[model samples]
Target: MSKSKPTPPPATPTPREAVSNAKLEELDQNREDSHGQFLTTNQGVRINDDHNSLKAGERGPTLLEDFIFREKMTHFDHERIPERIVHARGVAAHGYFEAYDNNASLTRAAFLQPGVKTPVFARFSTVAGSRGSTDLARDTRGFSVKFYTEEGVYDLVGNNMPVFHIQDAAKFPDLVHAVKPEPHNEIPQATAAHDTFWDFISVTPEAMHIIMWLMSDRALPRSLRMMEGFGVHTFRLIDAAGKSRFVKFHWKPLLGVHGVAWEEAQQVSGKDPDFHRRDLWNSIEMGAYPEWELGVQVVEEEDEFKFDFDLLDPTKLIPEDLVPVQPLGKMVLNRNVDNYFAETEQVAFHPGHVVPGIDFSNDPLLQGRLFSYTDTQLKRLGGPNFHEIPINRSLCPMHNGQRDGHMRQAINKGQTSYSPNLLNDNFPKQAKQAEGGFVSHPERIEAHKVRARSKSFVDHYSQARLFWNSQTEVEQMHMVKALRFEIGHVLQESIRSRMLILLSQVSEDLAARVAEGLGLAVPSAEGVQINLNVGADTDPAPYQSGPAKADTGRDSALSMAVTAKANAGKESIKTRHVAILATDGADLEAIADLMKALMDQGAQTAIVATHLGSIKGENGQQMLVNGTFQSTASVLYDAVYVAGGAASVAKLKQDADAVRFVNEAYRHCKPIAASAAGIELLKAAAYPGATDILDAEGVVTSDDAQVGELAKKFMAAMAQHRFWDRELKAMPA
Candidate 1:
């Protein structure tokens, strides 16, 4: 076997469309700039008047000869098409993926080569929700991207989580059915905190590892701009020399991974159902584009079995400790979709849509997705011609004999469409590997057809324990609370009892803490029988999980707080939304100094007050308010800053909404800063007692309103994301 080092792969013709910023220019050509253009009909005919359609008279009925109205109305009437079955609710943005260095050594994928800029359309979604569902649901976030590379549109479809619930594709439908609203009532929507879901989790041993992740804080992403995405299954990267190495793909946000508290997520969902959608759109429109670095963990073919767990198992991870992730490139989303229906809703992503160097692994889950994605698009997009959609169309010229689908856009002029024909001079012949044609990695395989899983997949609990041991104390406590909240919603007592036993297999402490919240004792594992009646005819006893090994140690990367706490500089606060609470008679100097510093660091600030328009300072300075008490909430911002003004603070003290804003920010563990008279507001908020008010963990206060020391201290606290150490003493807002 070849060693797992960067080596030149077999040569293939360089693609014509593989030039830097080619997609950006291509997209710009299609962009319409209405600044100096006249209003026109669909056929580009200029219209003298748009407000009123052609009619017999000023008050007469509109005539059928008015084709413009008819065309406009017809298109508007059919604007909406079918949403995706799984990832129905989603938001997408246009960006370019830039390679850091020539990766021709690891893989001959043109987009991975040095300095190549591949245009990309990334769609973030919440699975198990309808097109109108809230973005804050506790479900897996879909992180699918369509990379318009020279070879083709290579789609790297994945999720925010690295692991999945089921190990095989065959169980995908069953898993979805269990997690979705129940067939009888269809009661709960976009959540896994119901009986049917817990029932499935209680019995499926393969779901244990994913359950640990689902119950963690990762599910509650603070912002789409700050979440980490994973390609989940093991894939293959082929060198030009035809050598292949198993690889896992990762997307690390430059802003650092962060998440909101569960309580805050739920409240935000009610207040603004489009929280994530609005956040992403606003950030991009503000020119604060979201960015994520593409990374990979590569393993040699010979070393695939070196790990205790099977690399082919979709429910497992290679643990960053075992194989470190190497950053290869960066993807920045800079543009929003022009039309939601034409682009965001219609883009089809497939794992099968790969470039020359990237190929598929025999991972059961990946194999299933390869087939499912195309089938889904065919049905949902109204035909096999879904790829003809502008968003899905590849930048590279496509010439295939396949034609005439339900919605054929390209009008073929040639009479002869067959191959090796004299009529059309045998046009569009297939190119070889030397001429830019895709060549799959040649791996020798000798295997018998079987329906059984590999024996290596049977050890399911060890890594689960490793993940359990990896979390920080704050994260672990959050997991316990999540389990309690989720399992407590299960109406059936037996389901709750079995889940505790399974949790015990991972950790007694975990099960014991969750059980205490449910007012139940931990069930004995010896007497428990694993349910294997999931439409399968097999012996259930063999599948009953044994206790995890004691050697299952920690993988520090599993903890979000640990990783986030380490990220420094402007990236930590880039595009962070901060709310500055102030009123009339506030010190304009303090507010101006604070806002200027925050904006200079790339953090967005909003002046929030009891009313909109402008508020007057004591020094006769006028300040504009971005939002009013009725328009905004604390859940919308990352941190809160109170500007000093004796008269301003005195008036704000009378308003219940202003007091509640500071209180809620503190309860959420967000950084709170105040200065001079602004200190009165912090005192009126949380833990309002004895000692010093200026020295709290994340609280920054100053008597001087110039904001010199206060700004620096506040910036440092905001970088921390959350003050988890204050969780124990935090009172309700």
Candidate 2:
């Protein structure tokens, strides 16, 4: 008799092996690298001439009988899919999130266990733009992350701004349509600076709070890695004992929050429309991984009604002063996508995608998103089986009684697909709560459903005033300039007048500053209609929001300057791009010394010369040129450094592009440094204290100091990122 085969030992997966690579392994089955392969049709038939389609005698019209041509043309015609109505311009990356410690007391999520690493896919995009729009547009950015956990996929779909323009999802379409280019002309692509948007904002007072953010520097991020992200809606975190606590999600970047000036952003758009996308991709490729800490503000269920603002309101934020964010874990994005369309474009995210420990609150906007996301994926991805797409599939085992639909990828082998079937002996049964099944929190609900909102959501201007009050003087001035630039584009004078009325409700000082720019007076609220969102027959008096006092007068957490100050101790020049302006005969010691100092601190440097290729140093040493003045601009870098040499300074002083570079960097409030003869070049440019500079003037230069000492002072200034104090003395580039 043949010896019976010994039963193989049970296969076991480590904690990291189970969750970190399951999704990637599944996707690997479909991944294909076209290199070293013959070109073939969809059916694996080798092709001859993919460039030219089958035609009659090479010049006549294509023949209908050509099957290969028909197949190729058919596929090409349908290659394009419907872009998202919002967030059409996006970039994504692959990463892993590692928990700091086990917190089963707070959440039973397996991914949140101590030292557990879960793979994640994150996408960042600008709203109000098509797939072809510029990445530097002044708009809200979508910051959505998908965690491939052991239990299931949990999506945290959020935005760079903590608040939204509307309180309810029902009004989302209207808001998008208004912010989009006008239907008649389709002008002003990828921006909200038009008559229709301001007209809609003048009526929707609930949008005032977010409108303030949209008009601030937060709307113009310097890079994708330097901005903060917020979940924007209140969610619930249920413990093992079934107790639920209110939670708000936040993503604080390792790099402190930073933004470009309005004019600098415009220049970046003109020079490189894909500025943010290219920066993210190049950084990851160069091993400079971007990182952010995952934090959550947790509040007890009993304290929900304690805050002056409703926790369910989407247009408000719970100030960190009241409930400080607790650090939970950290996320590091270290990989770029191999194929943009297969992964980044096809990935689907939904606010309703939650594991056992995480749940949702009764936020109107959140509730609306639950239904809207599924419907959108259905229409955009071809059917109900969008989850079967490799990038969107859950890492856990998914099984149900559901049958095949369009684009279904799963195959059930059993005789029965129903739960109570005897043919298959009732296989693939459901799990109990103790067995890792999700059980919704049993919070009692006894009230009847209504079409109206609670009175708690009406205090909209209070948070708006709080945000306006929290900004520093320079930040406030920038906001005023941004408002002037946006509102000045509006052709309707009445829309401008209405915006002034709304601004007055937030702060009279804000309104007056904006009015001064537009050459208009602050409109009176007594005669203006502040509640145009009401129905034709409904009374508008109750919907009109009056100026209310802020719960926390002015939280420092709302100010980027305050955040930068707090992060000063931990700040470094890591991943910062610096421009070293030089030409032939530049001082070799000064260039090598500063470059080495910057590289030692994890900073990146590019030598910008009069031309590409190599430039000769004063000591006959050769240095490679990364870019020329014509190819790279001041807006593309974080700081400017002038390398010292007699010949280099003379050439730079004569080159108009070099002088313009220094002038623009000064105008944008970027750190500028020079050494020895480099100071002569700075004098030729237009900047304050360039003739007789001090270390404190943000223009780091010295006549008698050692090169090492100058490098130290320059790096210290670079750590500050930007010197906003010089903004007031800025001149035209």
Candidate 3:
């Protein structure tokens, strides 16, 4: 009867609805327009058949006269750019770095001033993987951050591990080539467990330090947010008075360093190729921003040589016991990238991108990176003017005489483009030292011109031994298993034999365990030419580089068990996933109370079941299932809970998938709990008989009266993250 039309409902947000929409508005252009519009050509012409191209006739060759077909085909053909040479697979985030105190005492860089927040674009990547490779590849992780400071972009390019595989930059290409897939057939996509890698590393003992780290749990990160980042090179921090201190940069994660089991990492690669990306995106959407504290091991210039190993050595690390890490600032990644390709892929980072007070050291590997990063970006991003890209643009003012190149965004209008000109009154002139000019630290370097590396860099195995001696028994066992897994994959017998001999140089026990896994005897190192002083034909005996000093004390920082101490006392489990396993006839009240307590502590609870959609509850309440057992697995959740109701428990116990879910979670050492009759499900899963799991370790099983207390006890266990000691008891998943 009424001619007036009903008002249209408010437009819904994007798929990631809970994200910071206010920040999204800052990105200019057609996000809103594209959302409600129909598909169109690049020129905005409406298109109907995007699924099929125009042809001469049905199933015939297309004609060049069809503008829509040609445009679509051309765009798709050039859609991809050259992927990165090393860090090909990656994810990025936008964030800000805030200085905790005035680090003016160490560096005069304005970004390090107290309370200054500098915009940052950080990229986390797996080195040596193709763009389409799985994120869980067992390889080095590249952790690079670009701080868009007032002076310039200061990039702290580093890795998850503190050390590197080579001492000199000259050996970098060779190292990458060796670890990459075989030259004959690119067989392995993203792995180092091959013959060529072992063959090259057998003689290059300088890699021993990094080898230990690679085989350890650090290489397999649990989450990008939980990984530790290290500036692998020793850098210099210059003060106002021109005094310099050798500093080792470190990123101490707020969540603490932790990693998934190797078996679980493999499982994740198959179940969810985008597990890490999804985790980070979901965490940010839930308002749980990842955080890390920036710290530095500041060594006085006078004390640089006090340690046995050279501080400038890329393959070595200064133990935390010698110099404690001082927290200078903190970095919080609060936003995900708007465009993956434009921001995460095109953003280039280099060690040379520094401001006033931060300067480079003589680390050979770092020296090479200074030039390689710029060169690679030129080819991959298509030009030198890539800085004009929004994500890579500096937040502060930028003025320079640099003119147009490929893909240039700025149009300069002047008579003169070169410096030292008077026509434009020397416009865009350089700043003086006091006027925020960037001046490299004037370190004295008078030396003979020769193609020779410093002999001080020769001591590699000392720190390698230090790393081995520092690991806990659990970590050490993981390394042993990892080594066996890798060496077993090698096709050549000599490579495996050489590996056994080389590993003996680290530890006899380690060598023996790995040898047993390969079903071979421990090979003798008598004929091995370890390092040989970089092929100079020097005496191989002295070049062996065994522990320089056996009395070196263990460093707690080397172990995740010690580094994760902070996580053990954290108040909440924000962003942690908890799976609520239930079936038809599940108790409605008990499940609701448990979810409330967990949600109050910031843990996300998802109701997982034998099937999707809704499940019938005992109280006539319908429960919305988040996912089904066919879709969700134990590895996806931080913890698991079995809801009560006699019928629900009986049904779950009879279901093999449900039994396996509980058993697998137990096998992975994750915290598990049950309420009332739900304990029967755990018993049906064949839980190990150690103590009454009701209160033993992280497994909590309570009857009806104690259901209220179960939530409290469960959250506390989840905060600790993992119940690692449960690994002592074996169970079949």
Ranking by TM-score: 2, 1, 3
Top-scoring candidate (lDDT): 2
What TM-score does candidate 3 reach?
A: 0.86
TM-score of each: 0.87, 0.87, 0.86
lDDT of 3 by residue, 1-733 (tens): 8799888856986656636575566564444555767667789887643322333222122233556544554443233368876888999888899997758899888889889998888899999778888888888899999999988788999999999988755456657778878867987889998888888788788898899999998988888988999999999999877789999999988877778778878888998978888888888877889999999999999997798888877899989988899999999999998888878877888787888889888775676566556666676788888778877777778777788899998777767878888888887888888998878777665443333455677776677778888887777888988999999998888888888876777777889999999999987777556543322333345445554455556898898866665458863687789999998989978888899888987789999988888999987889899998889888888899999999888989888989999888877778899988998888877555644455446898788734678888788888777766555555411
Which portions of model 3 miss their true places by more than 4 Å? 1-81, 531-548, 565-567, 687-696, 731-733
Relative to the true structure, candidate 2 has a C-alpha RMSD (angstroms) of 18.9
Question: Model 2 compared with the native: what TM-score?
Answer: 0.87
RMSD of each: 20.4, 18.9, 17.0
Model 2, CA-based lDDT: 0.84
**Reference-based lDDT, each prediction:** 0.83, 0.84, 0.79
Give the winner by TM-score: 2 or 3.
2
Report the backbone clash tally of model 1.
Answer: 5
